[model samples]
Target: MLDARGLVIVFGLALGASACGGDDSSSGGGTGGASGSGGAVGGSGGGATGGTSGAGGGTGGASGSGGAGGGSGTGGSAGSGGAPCFDAKRLWFEDFETGDYSRWTSKTYDKNWNNGFCHDNGFSTAQANSPTHSHRSEITCADTQSHRGYGGLQFAGDSVVPAYTNQGSGIDAPNGVVNTYWSWLEAPYAFQNGKWFSFWTVNNDCGWKDNVITLGLEDTSNKLTPAHIKNTGGTVTFAPNAPGFPMGKWVRTTIYINYHEGVMVTWQDGTKVFEATFSRPDNDICQWHWGAYASGDNDDVVLYEDDNSIWKLGQKWTNFDVEPYFGVTQAVCSP
Candidate 1:
């Protein structure tokens, strides 16, 4: 069944969408639907009571408790025994299930320079991490310009998700607040033979109008390596210690930006890829955006994105074991 996080545990049943279908972290893991009000994955009949302080775990073993039924459940806890508890709220999430870009604040394409190649952006059903639809962007050729043919979405500031400041202590500080983005990406064979495809970037629209942090795929000498752009406009490319970016399949990616501390971390399929300190200190994370951009050389490059989410990690420094609020089963616990 689909829990409050809108995640479906495909044991043998169907799924349900969230009330704020366009922009909420409704994807989570569990069997029985949540019980009290907001609904968390409970054990037997229902799970914990929905409020600031959870009432009781469900009847069974896999129950957890959190405010407004927002906690993820494990094999034990809440009413049963030792399940973990977490509280999180969604800043933005676009599963592309609506089959359009209606959820985004704005859309951008190839920066007024039409290369005459096939720079396209839309929805696709070919492959999706969620189930039905996903955002697809394809580029056909290389660009000599710095900002090449790119098609993407812009997530500006809104009421539910306001701007955050990066002026706290260093990494892992107690006053740290993290803003994380989770998404599934796939590129069949575009990242081959020294081609670079920019999947997402956090740009500063307020002061310097520069990219504070950027992540992309760089095929250096035919070896797949993740690339990042520093706030000072310098490029740092390194191969992952673990398995590199795989071709022809979807991979889970997580980008964590600490607003309290000027630190950024990246993970691919639960493995740490890289970590860096933001050069631009005391910056505001209000106008940052993400997209798919093709640079260097390109030949029939295609990228697919599904089940994208932005979350506010209040006390959690990293996204590890926070909750299964994105349709995937995560280790249940308190952070």
Candidate 2:
């Protein structure tokens, strides 16, 4: 998002286009040598009386040229150019149900389900340590309840219950508001693991606030088992341009992580959003839990969720491509 200062710069550039000046004309030729300048001023030569230039017929005053067309006004710069398009392969979660866990290894830790406050039936809840919020509760899974059946990973308000009273602390809240969301795959996870991914959203007293989708990978390591972990954070805030984002409605969020040397680029809704490079190797030991962690009350929570599919890492785009075909045309008969 652009800050106030950037807006000022943009406005200044826009004003520069009007700086061109208008035109001015030089005085026309003096009324020719006043007919008496020469010796025989016979009748001032009628038409030539103004001067030897024959009065130049007043030159019709040069028709006042039409303002040079204002140089076409520069067209206002085309509105930031549309986002580039890229080919995407859809990876569904249902594929994992048939024992295709070869590409993905679910972090096999048990989540001690919470029986309090009526847990949403859709989420696989758990408790875990959050880097930013310290320890918090979280939820994970897709929202199958929606007609589109897209996946989503979420964190609940109760997870950060302790920090609720610690509001206004810059260390935890940048906007001075209490927020609960997803924990991204940090350093240790990215260095050792090959792929890390998640889908999440932010909710508060205002209802469904916005969405932030992420995906990353980690390498193998001595300190951890999985080797590496990485992910991306792409946020879609509440604004007019962001369509299909419903307040209190389930929006489908997805992420695909592409790992490159030192850099990982993540795509949300088929568009690239986050890119970062790592200085040290990041790897983890297990396939992390989705809902809640085994030991803490701070777990990731999700609502309006479903888990009908699973996809593996390292699968090529071709694995999910569906080719289009045209059948033979039928002939029509007329009376």
Candidate 3:
């Protein structure tokens, strides 16, 4: 579900922590069972360091509506087709139903970086993406520092995903790789500025760490800082972080790299919150890492990932706009 190695290269932000149990989630949208209780253990702050400043609280708008009470609700629209798929061959698929990390160990996405499963820090099937026997990937950060060795399950594309070099070339033109992280659980310690995690696309083929985005908390605002896509001439749209990004919910993010159109689209919870035209010449994508990374030490931070969360987006799905706001399973994608 993650390419942890690419995270280190991109933002030095580590992806980690236990399941978040997305509290305050509604029945139709956002993951449930996120009571923020039970197996929800607070990570040890490593007696060696002091506590973090933590995040400032954010408020959501009220749902009080002034409408015609007599009017009946309109029929809901039909949904998109197909379940989440990865790659043209579906070889990168992993639901973890077998309860193992064999898909990662079976073949390294790029051995030039690391090899085998980084089971030292470890990942297992503890959290459930769904109560009906569906499980999620609970990735633990290294007890020490940045887990560069092998903390992710990389899914290599036939050609780089989202075609890194050229905008209109390859799958990135129409079909880009999509990965969603159900931060269904987050320990209290994960609220610091040093908190960083890479969710999707990071170029492992070469060392172009520009558009490679990483999730983190902005020290000043204490909001989750979304990743930015960069071009050749030190160009980047320094946008503000989303108000309540990783606060114990499944934040669905989609990255659409359009070199031809000269635009890069970032969708959060199914909204086109950020868009930028790249001045760079070309773009190439290699892998997607669903694990953890850290700016400082791995500490006790541990992030959760749903086994069925990773997805492949057919070109048209990108234009769905906010259709996916209903959360993961309910949101439809083109086959």
Candidate 4:
């Protein structure tokens, strides 16, 4: 079972070391103390550190969404309200409505990581249902479902000198804010029994949260199923999907993470698939990768993601792209 231990090691080994000459010594982007006021989003867990004060975008405007007050500061549990309000402001968005891969970044170009450039290809009937041009990602060479390839980009290599490898620049999330990633996604390929695909989310120091394993319990049907997990420290619980959850169709996936509140929520096509409130491996949530990850016979698998959006509550999310907009950085994993 790849638990938090494996993640700590992998992330530590890959990005924990001093990155030579990077913006920040850590694998993530430069950190500025978030300064904004979290509107009185009531929850008993009053730290209200919501990245608040003298700032550009944050402390977070987390309004009183959780029973007005339920948990401790920096950690929140489910309150009278099943969940917080969905009114968080949007941090970023992409519908491909423009029909161009603008701020969007991908690995399909890098060859070292299994034709990581396939996503760069023109629409493979990319949209299941879109009024405008859409794109899909196809990979035929990747055989493993373990660590991702960051689209053939390099992560923080083991360098003592602050290696300046820019993977998805400026995309890192600031501390103490409610950040969310939402997109319409579909896997058109037929389900391969036992084969798994995954994605990344902000958690345990804004590292990868494997959706494949955490999505569901073991089932005989071999389809996508998210698991239900609750916190050992807090009261928020996660609901897992059954072995027979729907697949092969476009589903809307929304992930919400509030580092200050220590809450994480996942929704599939509007249904809450998983939710958890956690506080461990201390540090604010940092970054996320838009990887339509797949495993086993990737040659035949294709993933469609469209209308991607980033939502930030209590503070507008930060942008991590460069001017003139050539491309963004991605954490290309070493093969």
Candidate 5:
């Protein structure tokens, strides 16, 4: 089993020391300490020290209904409250409404580590946010293997850094985010489980094994508590034991990463949950993985993801400027 330290070394070697710049060197950005102590909305985690909290957009208006023929796998017009199910212009998007797993493949860096997922059927037509189907991520603890799922772009060596440009410029680049959205639905577990569902990492071998910040939930006293994990030299847990990930319901999370400012802010179900400064603007985003990256303990786990999208604002902007476009405006769907 690859421990946290093992993973960090793997990533550091892959990306090289120079690619990472420096660790724990955050200047400016975090304010009012680390927020998200209470379980209430808008009170979740704060940004890194010296960095001010990028004010978050409030829970958007009412949830919009899915379009009449949104499952066609094509961009359709918005219904009442929701945006189109698909947008060809987006940097990338995956709704699984096509009833297949064609948009995903093995990890762009380490194919074997992906555990043969997405090669076969992994969709449930009944449980989805846009009506038809959603990707299902399952893990058998007895197998003692980690599970990983990919969405968005399959980033590679040369494709990483150049995907977005004009960092810190007040104008937008083609790949910069106007808003990026992803979500997870926790299926009822027969036993308590620890599962890391989202990972953004970089490495030289394209292995994506280092400096991973994971957003996942752990079952405590029969309730799932939200947590953001930073696994660099070791494992550090932020926003621990905070209540937000509700049981058996879809929790949509929005992420705003100011590559220019080296800051990241995350919101869950329209509430700000996590913010941090980890990488500099020069560091490239090597890989993005969403699934059971780390299967903690021996417990069966199942999760669902849908309506994953990356929408570029068409010009460069900071987290503070994009506050108006963040949060979950669509109606919450259940599994």
Candidate 6:
């Protein structure tokens, strides 16, 4: 509990003396005016009249001015700060538990690994028919291959691999592929026109590898692509090479969309890295996906993702009773 209190003191002092002391009677034949003492009678033998003495100086008035009022002091309340508040009804996935699949979809090639291609069960695989699975593996680099890694569905876990086998895509072409790191975000269905929001992070290859994060806006007419779309204009790329960027570490990425403005801001750890606004309207509203595609087959290239979560802006976490999959609150500070 906290309390506040105020204290005040007032004081006043007078500066001048009162005018109450004055003589009135005269001695002999002379009369004296107000404040003067009468003198003794002149040399006459007769007894001289008594002179009145001036009244004593009036007492001086009291001393200095009134004092001022004092200010109040208050004690601040105690509580936790930076706790993340998420919408329980709107959560897509937590603790890698799949609630529904109709809301998400994925893109896969039948048998074509054109870039250092291999259907070698290492990269992409499905998690237990459930929306979430324990899928974790690294894509290693190779010398002759242009694109060394395979893209796959990532789930929640510190480090655990699902017990599924990866199907092969036999179109291995080293030169046609490039080396890069990226991730994917799958949604059961298309997001509403003005109600979709998503956030995630992508890990870079330390050196020589170009890592990027993409928000697949399947809706071609909606606005939100101008700030991210490159010359080819297919998908918006959040890259680490941008100027004033704090590169070489994990960076947090955010996407906010509505009618007025489609803004994208990326932060390194917790500090802002880059912000971009798109002039063109984005209309894509299909299932979203995040992953990597490279130019050469350098199997060593990889991307890491964690703390993947989403929420509608202005929504509070307490309104819903849904718990996080891991049994812990996913609410986190902006770090």
Best by TM-score: 1
Cα error, candidate 5, residue 113 (Å): 9.5
Q: Kindly list the per-residue Cα lDDT of model 4 for residues 1-335, writing each as its tens digit.
A: 01111111001111111101111111111121111100011111101000001001122112211111111112122212233222233333333344332333231222223333332223323343333433344454544322232211112211111222232122223433332222222344443343344433222322232111122212234332322122124433435551233445555444555545555555444455445555544433323334333333334434444434343343422321110000111111111
Task: Give the TM-score of each candidate.
Answer: 0.57, 0.25, 0.50, 0.47, 0.52, 0.33
lDDT of 4 at 294: 33
Summarize candidate 2's per-residue lDDT along 96-179 as a digit string, tens digits. 111111122111111222222222221112211211111112233322111010111111221211111212111111111111
lDDT of each: 0.35, 0.16, 0.30, 0.28, 0.32, 0.20
TM-score of 1: 0.57
Candidate 1's clash total is 12
Which of 3 and 6 is the better model by lDDT?
3
List runs of model 4 lying over 4 Å from the truth: 1-87, 105-129, 141-194, 203-245, 296-299, 315-335
| Candidate 1 lowest-lDDT run of ten | 45-54
For TM-score, candidate 4 versus 6, the one ahead is 4
Q: Model 5 over residues 125-153: C-alpha lDDT tens digits?
A: 44555545565544444333323323222
All predictions: root-mean-square deviation over Cα? Answer: 15.6, 36.6, 15.3, 16.5, 12.9, 44.3
Candidate 6 residues 149-260, lDDT tens each? Answer: 1222211211111211112121121111011111222223332232221121111111101212233121222111221223212233434543221112333333332212
Off by over 4 Å in 2: 1-92, 95-112, 122-246, 258-260, 279-302, 307-335
lDDT of 1 by residue, 1-335 (tens): 11111111101110111110000112111222111111111111100000000111221111112211122222123321333444433444455565433444332222222433434555566655555655555554544422232222222332211212221222222323232232333444644333455444443333223332445554432222223233233333333564466655676666556544555555566565555554444434433334444443454555565555444443464443232232233222332
Model 2 TM-score, 2 decimals: 0.25
Tell me how far the alpha carbon of residue 166 in candidate 2 is from the true structure, in angstroms, after superposition. Answer: 33
